[model samples]
Target: MESESSSESSLEKSMENVLHLQNSDNPGLILVIAPLNGTNYLPWSRAMKIALCAKDKIGFVTGEIKKPSKNSPMFKKWRRVDSTFWESNGPLLYNIKREISLFTQGNMPLMVYFTKLKKLWDEVQCLRPFLVCTCGNCTCGASKAIADFDEDEKLIQFLMGLGDHYDHVRNQMLLIDPLPSASKAYSMALRVEKKKDV
Candidate 1:
């Protein structure tokens, strides 16, 4: 009995780290939650970034380790995405350039990240996105940092709650795991594209 009660308490605490039900109010924004670190980060991120922009929806990216400074490598890349990733997707560069402000700028502690994420969601209430996608180990360290017990389940439950908060019909909140391969990311991107077409 004690073990089960402890488990419930742990789950609630974990949810608090990732989500605050009261703060959930984005009607149509497709929030792309993702981690900044990983092997296939570039290809996966680039693919989804292009796909989201191509679909004419703003990709509000979160879960970055640190906000890019003016002198950061990421900033430099953002400056020259056109020439750099042109072969892959030329127009996405333009789209990112146009919507660059939507992204968070700097590194933060996990707790602060969640706080700011909630605030950003509230601020962008008017955008109204078609889908909210999560990518590449986006449990926001729930499995490790937040709680060791049922962290994955807590993350999924939190996401599902967000879907409800955003009024998503079903399957609108996507989880793209790039560890399997970039193919999975591409497949997820295609789904987003097809959904946009409809």
Candidate 2:
């Protein structure tokens, strides 16, 4: 009987620990100092792990803790933390793609418009990174081909998002034998904007 009561006490304590949220814990809490800017993924991920571990919430990210049923007492807090940290690929990916599809330069300056679109593009790349060739002896050049295709797609998207005033410039860019890269395209557009300003 004593052992049974002790076991129950231990279980209750564990549940309490899992459900507890400190004053600092909230949905809007920023987990890492530096955001994952594609290039610094290693250090950024390490920092995130340390932060989540400190909060005793690493299990949620690591998949060690399964999501609780809606009626479960832990469900609400679990959801809040999960949404804050976890970048689930489905809905988030769809939303980012939709934003990119709809993005356009209206009244914003060329630099401002390009910066915003660049951010969205970076997020898309981060979320769906290009797959590296793993086999050591392969020589098909498929990886490079895929990368070139990706760049071309981005170039097209960038051209498509420009204002109607850039129709002539956009048409000229599309006519090039080898289309310019997205950065080059941006520079071309900036020149046009500057000429107009003058």
Candidate 3:
């Protein structure tokens, strides 16, 4: 992934400059946190393309690698170990990139101003976050994958328990795809919540 966050990609619909995510002109909407990895579980990745079909705005933070050859052997080994979660939800491992930033160039901001960069996950949490979804390789390894169909559905039900619905509607789903790196297709729903901060 990229060391620093880059410009907002037209590849996805995002509104990184807008603050105050509640009481807008609309009813129910979502703020997605995509991992952009090519896995079947991470909703953040392009695997679940259908979920984005409905009307909504999405924000993006894309990482890139100019030279894959430069990474340590340990990184490659770690990825290989993680891909075992295809059949079910396992403990997720994080390969947190060095850092990422907002996708807009709205106006002039000095290093200090930019450092005031408060729009990361802390800000996301402040929004009362209706949905928090992630999909990627299994946490333990392929030997411990969740391969049963019913068990998979149970995982979805578990995720739904994470929050409440924002729309007068229930079971809100999204699928956005034709992503550049998706290895398989996936679908997920993240309930919407309004801003919870003062």
TM-scores for the candidates: 0.17, 0.59, 0.16
The C-alpha stretches of model 3 lying farther than 4 A from their native spots are 1-14, 17-24, 28-54, 58-136, 139-145, 149-198
Off by over 4 Å in 2: 1-47, 52-87, 135-138
Could you give the candidate ranking by TM-score, starting with the highest? Answer: 2, 1, 3
- Name the best candidate (by TM-score): 2
Per-residue lDDT of model 1, residues 1-198, tens digit only: 999999978965643332322233233333345532222345556666775455322222432222246975454433333222223223443443333234332454333433443433332332223233244565555434323232343234333333232334224434333122222323443465467669
lDDT of 2 by residue, 7-30 (tens): 978965775586577788766678
Relative to the unseen true structure, what is the C-alpha lDDT of residue 161 in candidate 1, on a scale of 0 to 100?
A: 32
- Predicted candidate 3 versus true structure: per-residue lDDT over 12-32, tens digit per residue: 122221211235323332323
Where is the poorest 10-residue window by lDDT in model 2?
129-138
Backbone clash pairs for candidate 1 read: 28-128, 28-129, 29-129, 67-105, 67-106, 67-107
Q: Tell me how candidate 3 scores on lDDT.
A: 0.27
Q: What does candidate 2 score on TM?
A: 0.59
TM-score of 3: 0.16
lDDT accuracy of residue 179 in candidate 3? 23
